[model samples]
Target: MRAILVLLIIVVLVAIAAIALGFVNVSQTRTASLPTISVKGGSAPAFNVQTANVSVGVENHVVQTPTVDVKKP
Candidate 1:
């Protein structure tokens, strides 16, 4: 159910985006063109972050269960 809801929401958003971008509309006033972009050298920020390492493993164990006595009426 949650998956369906999420899918519906995504589909609605996609439809909205399509309509907003005029992709759904068949009429076009003008041709679209890509903008010329210039790039510059830039340095990214660095972070010294510490994180905890969690290790997980499974262990085998033996368990004893009590036997039930059933009486037929």
Candidate 2:
């Protein structure tokens, strides 16, 4: 019984110490600088007349399996 009581006290003390450490860590200030970006629209470029001819082709193939076997005992 005494051993169990001492073990319980030790466990409680460890828990209290962990809680205190966590509080200390939580209270500390963190210093960090984050990046910032700014954008602004200016004058647009003048448009020019253009012409183009384009062609495209695509091909697809398929596969076939003949036999599959499974055995269990």
Clash numbers, per candidate: 0, 0
Tens-place lDDT per residue, model 2, 1-73, is 9999999999999888988888534455888888898879888799998879777889897989789788897
Residue by residue across 1-73, what tens digits does model 1's lDDT show? 9999999999999999999998898678999999999999999999999999999999999999999999999
The residue ranges of model 1 lying beyond 4 angstroms of the native Cα positions read 1-29, 64-73
Return the TM-score for each candidate structure: 0.36, 0.31
The local lDDT score (0 to 100) that residue 33 gets in candidate 1 is 100
Which candidate number maximizes lDDT? 1
By summed lDDT, which 10 consecutive residues of candidate 2 come out lowest? 23-32
Q: Go through the candidates in order and give the C-alpha RMSD of each one to the true structure.
A: 11.1, 13.5
Worst 10 contiguous positions by lDDT, candidate 1 = 20-29
User: Which residue pairs of candidate 2 clash?
Assistant: none
Q: In model 2, what lDDT does residue 37 have?
A: 83
